[model samples]
Target: MATSARSQTQVYELRVYEIGFFRSADVLHTYFENALIPALNRQGAKNVGVFEEMGESLPKKVYLLIPHKDIVTFQDSERKLFDDETYLKDADPYLTADQATIPFNRISTSLVHSTKEFPELTVPNSAGIYELRIYESHNEGALKNKLRMFEDEFSIFADAGLNMVFYGKNIYGDHMPCLTYMLANTDLNDNKEGWSKFVNHPRLEEIDVHGGIQR
Candidate 1:
């Protein structure tokens, strides 16, 4: 595993695409695999994650995780992508498709900053299913409190053998007051076991007892 300085925070843009039909899913997959992802790589993004949500969540969804070392790089990357002729030409299939044959029904975006405790994103191995979770808070105070819990107790997930890909506090998104994190396992059974271990961990119970949650 790799480690970086605590002050080295990364910004992430989370893009969720709503696939209305199988055809739409196919179209979007092609765009990301052939065009968008390659474009991002060329612009200096090393680990852009593309994932399909697993299970029955209706209409299907695709997630894109784009990370940048700082705010300026994040903005610059977008500008560069738009300016790239190859990207534009490759993205034309999705960009120029008629409304009747659009690639996706809608797209949602969230901009989040990495927490100090986990300043760098962890790249997952190629053989697992990722579980993405968003913990929505009621207000700013609650959000900070929840993030504090993450700072202190998140290692419990590691102890449980759940590989954490990343954890971030939302700076901009539909769900403004939330923290999103992703954990992964090699298979469904391993996912279940890891989570079961986490919920039953004594450190979590200790945190709860020590006023980790206030209501």
Candidate 2:
């Protein structure tokens, strides 16, 4: 176990949604590099990462992890993003016309320490344990129950001795209809054994026992 895992820094999590039909993604990315990177640099942002779409059929989205001192500073800078002047200035004609890049709708949320960590498998070209999970609950008030069920599932995984590298969850900024998780894994027969135990638990049936929306 690489127990020396760094403390969870002040990470700002932003879900970015962009229209998928760009003529060429590379050009739009260059726009992002020229536009966003400098805007964020003006703020006190320490580090930033942007994860683009993985599978072919999905809409274009990016997950940003940036450092901030507190939510207040984050909010103040964010207001500028609403103004056309903030992202588009006369110096850049292509982006201002909104013709050169994809239009975006975004959502922002913080990643608390309680959230799960997913692995990156930094090794060279190796297939590692990674799973995309989607969660749904019928009852609007069933959040606690849902979390408990997740806890039960993780306990089973631990008993089986699987090492979970990374686990993170947040809804897509613009994509409704999905709540997702990124999982990192190594030696994951642990997952199979644990999940079987979790699904078989009798209490799971009682969770959100009343969340169906009638037509």
Candidate 3:
């Protein structure tokens, strides 16, 4: 698909893997780095992001970000993964691991539709710290208000030097009425400075009218 066309129709799949104590995460990382990402790339998915939680939080978590051309591609890609001979072969170690030796304790997945204002995912050129944030609302109406708030404040976010990677409304997953977004920064100091500017920005007072959106 053309870049512009794909951008407008893109959707994201965010997968979180919970790794148990005493269990090796290498199996999971190997699968993602050596198999799943390459297989997805061949199937036209791009900019797949694999990340691990910072510090020593346990159970440790691994995050996988997959961007699809559209809903159809998202639906079709799962079946295609199993059908791909190379993927199947490459993913064998993780796929065939014994239950007792499984890498992750559980996995949670969320499906998000690209927001009207930020309809595509942009991969950063250099390595940086990433923050994934989810905002939950009281109800669908409240969620709409929150989304509108985001749309209006996107410019303020940029003006504050925040590097937004992606923004979307959650359509499926644990949080019923929520939106998720990611931000990238060279370091924690950069993030702090950006937020400082954002909160103090005059534009924020005007757009901050929407209330009760929980983090």
Candidate 4:
């Protein structure tokens, strides 16, 4: 668990939406821009991030990264957002859309605990390209080792010029026994270069020897 000046660490909600078509995606984009973000802000949530998956394909995916003070805030905010008449009216377009024209085919969510190394969630700059990486391990031992690598050797990413926003273990989500993190770069070239450096970092040699590397 991450420790900071505050006694409690941040909790994160990762929401994944799978859209069925381009029109549905459009509705979703407008909903986030006009309704959801504003509602979340009203509830005291900050650094909320909305991202579309990289690499073009039909049935597009959207990722929402939300940071909360704790589990209580995460749980209460959604209920409050629903209760707000303004939010409900603003979001009604998407919420009341015909079943056949729904904004997403399905939605998945995950709860996360911030890592000790990076306890705060940061909103990536608009000019930067962000990469969200999910690492899965086969067993608990391997999972622990992978996390240890992140906590102890994540400085390698910084040394290589990649800006890591946050790293955390997903307490609840599909494909359990995994961890997730986000990295951002102002230029795609920097992203590529930084990752190349990270993979070859000497510290990773030790992590790999301990079976931390995962496909």
Candidate 5:
């Protein structure tokens, strides 16, 4: 919704993970809050975000985005950034000398191929609503974490009028025109009133939004 105000032509994604007896979210939290965002700004990135997996289907899921003008330039600069000495030094305290916190297990890289001709949607007044989306270059990929994300972890936003909606993807998109991401609409104006109501809410404790069944 935030990007609707401007024109976004290209996107580059970097997915991080700490799973399968390896990787650690603690490290990523530190890296992102400390080094990653700054590095991205230095490299000229737009619409950046930091996400956390609130569902149990997956463990330690965090994603980041960067808008670019051209795919080739994004890829080339990304390669250099990974090996940049400055980044390495800044990323040192949180990560091991060598990316030992998480190997290449869940790491992902993609150059988005937008839908053929995308249409602009009615960009809602999603003010104060935080939005995050994660995608891979495939037909039946994974995005299971969004379930707990909207249903519980951030449910207060909905009650407070934050208006939150989130969904997972199971289909492959065609190009720039295709709606590769799902619409997660939230009432952006939910104030602190909604936040206080979250304490010990029954649904907040239950992982399943619809009783034991997955919604």
Candidate 6:
């Protein structure tokens, strides 16, 4: 857990929407781009990210990342959205759609608290390919050790040329005892190169052999 006061720390909401076959994602994209994101920004959340899967797969998935000031804001998000006339009007198409026209088959959401080292979400000035990774541990103790390992190795990520976006522990989600983080790179090659450096770094090797948590 972060040392920062819980009230002051930021929280993130990760949402995955599953789109069924033959369903168009157009409505979902429109709602996110034109309504949800704008409404969230107005309510103090920032750097809300929307992402799609890279390759063809059954039941395509869309990922939404929303950073909130704190848990209170997250808890009240639905009410705030519903109360906003502009949001309601702009989101009508998706919100009022019947089952046959619904954009997504289902939605899965997770809430995470920012880690002590990475307390806020950083949005790069230019767009790039983003990667989101989740690490799951078997138990709470192992999760704590994993977080500590990250805290100790934080600088190595940047040193290896990886753009660290945000790191957090899952506070409320399907996967228990897990941590998630995201990275951005110029492109696929850039991503591969950065991670290559990361994996081969001596510091990472030392941590893996000596300081890493057994999970």
RMSD of 1: 2.0
- Candidate 6 residue lDDT tens string, 69-167: 889999999999999999999999888889988778899999989865778787765547999999999899889889988877677887876787778
Of the candidates numbered 2 and 4, which has the greater TM-score value?
A: 4
- Sort all candidates by lDDT, best to worst: 3, 6, 1, 4, 5, 2
Clashing pairs in 4: none
Q: Which candidate has the top score in lDDT?
A: 3
Ten-residue region with minimum lDDT total, candidate 6 = 1-10
Model 1: runs farther than 4 Å from truth? 1-6
Using TM-score as the measure, what is the rank order of every candidate, best first?
6, 3, 1, 4, 5, 2
Weakest 10 consecutive residues of candidate 3 by summed lDDT: 1-10
Q: Give the Cα error of residue 180 in candidate 5, in Å.
A: 2.3
Residue-pair clash count for candidate 2: 8
lDDT of 4 by residue, 16-78 (tens): 999876654777788888999999989988879898877778778999989998889988987
| lDDT (Cα, tens digit) per residue for candidate 3, span 176-196 | 899999988888898999999
- State TM-scores per candidate: 0.91, 0.49, 0.92, 0.88, 0.50, 0.93
Q: How accurate is candidate 2 locally (lDDT)?
A: 0.46
Candidate 6 clashing pairs, residues 3+ apart or interchain: none
Candidate 1 lDDT by residue in tens digits, 111-161: 889977788788876547888889999998989888888766667888898
Candidate 5 error regions (>4 Å): 1-8, 14-18, 21-24, 82-85, 98-100, 115-179, 187-215
Q: What is the total number of backbone clashes in candidate 6?
A: 0
lDDT of 5 at 90: 90
Model 4 has an lDDT value of 0.81
Model 3, C-alpha of 178: deviation from truth (Å) = 0.3
How high is the CA lDDT of each candidate model?
A: 0.83, 0.46, 0.86, 0.81, 0.47, 0.85
Candidate 2, residue 186: the lDDT equals 46
